[model samples]
Target: MSDKRQQLIETALELFYQEGVQSIGINEVLKVSGVAKKTLYHHFTSKEALVLATLETRNQRFSQWLTVQIAPAKNNQELVEHLFQSLKGWFEDRVEVLGEFRGCFFINTAAEFRDSESEISRYCRQHKSDIKQVIRQQMATYADQPDETLLERICLLKEGVITQAYVAQDMSGPEQAIELLKGR
Candidate 1:
């Protein structure tokens, strides 16, 4: 991506995370990014387009980070643990600084944009489905377990961890998820 485009996306994410999508305007992102309005519009036809791109950008960053975190794993089981280990670190960081952990970005965006066809909402759905697909693929490698069951359990655990981390400001929920996953 061009530096200007990336700057816009980064700026928008910061504003969206802080002031929320509904509150922040395109002008704010343009000003914070230090890019011209025409340039921003030239790159992203509309604010909605920019919103979708921002969501996809965040998803890509998270996926790439997760890939790096799991690179040392020797097998599927280790891979699963590595996944939770990352979440554990995330929660620890959140709790160490402040008790207010931002919940899942995709979930938050979906809630803000209830229309399924909205660019932000569509990107959120795609991002979430992509995450589940990764878990399903990893679970499928475990020949002994049913893929659907494992996916459902992992999804539940993920939601629980995020909820607990947001509300209780602790990593215990994700740690428990790792333990349960290990026993499977």
Candidate 2:
């Protein structure tokens, strides 16, 4: 991507994540990104197109971050532990580029979009499925035969952690997730 296009995406992602998609205007994104209105329009046909691109950018970034953060796991137990640890670090703003956690971006987008048929909502669902696939891949490597139920349970725990930490401001959610993992 050109510098202008990349800057617009990054700026829009930050604003859309911090503020709701509907709350942040195109002009605001252009101003924050230091890109001209024509430049943004040239890169993205419409505000919805820009929003989709922003979602795509965030999905790539967040998935990669999660993968890197948990890459050191040596076993199933370690994998589970590292997953929670990553969440804790994210909740505490230890990830420098991510800043403070504002809940899962995909989840936030889903809630904002509401309509299941909407493009944004579809992207949100796809991002979530991709996350579950990542967990399944890791579990498969660590187990002789990974159970789908176990994979779902782990994903549930992760979602719970994100929700509790972001909504209730309960930092212990990751620890609770670890305990849930231990029981499994």
Candidate 3:
């Protein structure tokens, strides 16, 4: 990626996370990204293209982070703890002495632009599906449990933890969720 295009993606992500995706316009991203209109257009044919790029960037970062987090775990139990600890770490990082922190950018964006048929929405849906698949794979490492039941339970718990931690401002919510999932 060109420096200009990379700047646009990074700046757009900051603005989108701080504000919102739909609320912020293409002109705003261009202005904030410090890229000329022609440069922006050269990289993205339209605002929807930029939006899809932004979502894909976020999805790539998330997948990379998750892969790193779960890489060291030996078993499903350790894997579950690693996942919860990662969420807790996010909470500790996101919440400083200041006010509340912004929640999951993807979840926020999905809510703001719910189920649209746009390319951005399609990328968002694919990212979510990938997330569920990751959980299913991890759950499979636990053996002895029915695959369907474990997949459903773990996916639900993961979603609940993500929402409760970010939206509900419960710092320990992810850890609590892990315990709940283990009990199940």
Give the best candidate by TM-score: 2
Which runs of model 1 end up more than 4 angstroms from their true locations?
74-77, 94-101, 139-146
Ranking by lDDT: 2, 1, 3
Ranking by TM-score: 2, 3, 1
Give lDDT tens digits, candidate 1, residues 1-184.
8999889988888788666788899988977888999989888998888888878887977666665666665565676688787777766653322223476777777889868797677788888778777665654455455457656787788878887887677668867887788856
The C-alpha local distance difference test score for the whole of candidate 3 amounts to 0.73
* Per-residue lDDT of candidate 3, residues 24-141 (tens digit): 9988888887799999889988877777787888787777677677667656667778877876776677533211347777778877875588566677779988876765666556
Q: Write down the TM-score of every candidate.
A: 0.83, 0.95, 0.85
Model 3 residue-pair collision total:
0
Candidate 2, residues 1-184, lDDT tens digits: the string is 8999999998999999999898999999988988999999899999989999988988888888888877777677788898999889999999876766899888888898758989989999899898888777777776788777867888888898899999999999888878877846
Clashes (N, CA, C under 3 Å) per candidate: 0, 0, 0
RMSD per candidate (Å) reads: 3.5, 1.3, 3.5
Off by over 4 Å in 3: 94-101, 137-148
Each prediction's whole-model lDDT (CA): 0.74, 0.86, 0.73
Better of 2 and 3 by lDDT: 2
Instruction: Compare the candidates by lDDT and give the number of the best one.
Output: 2
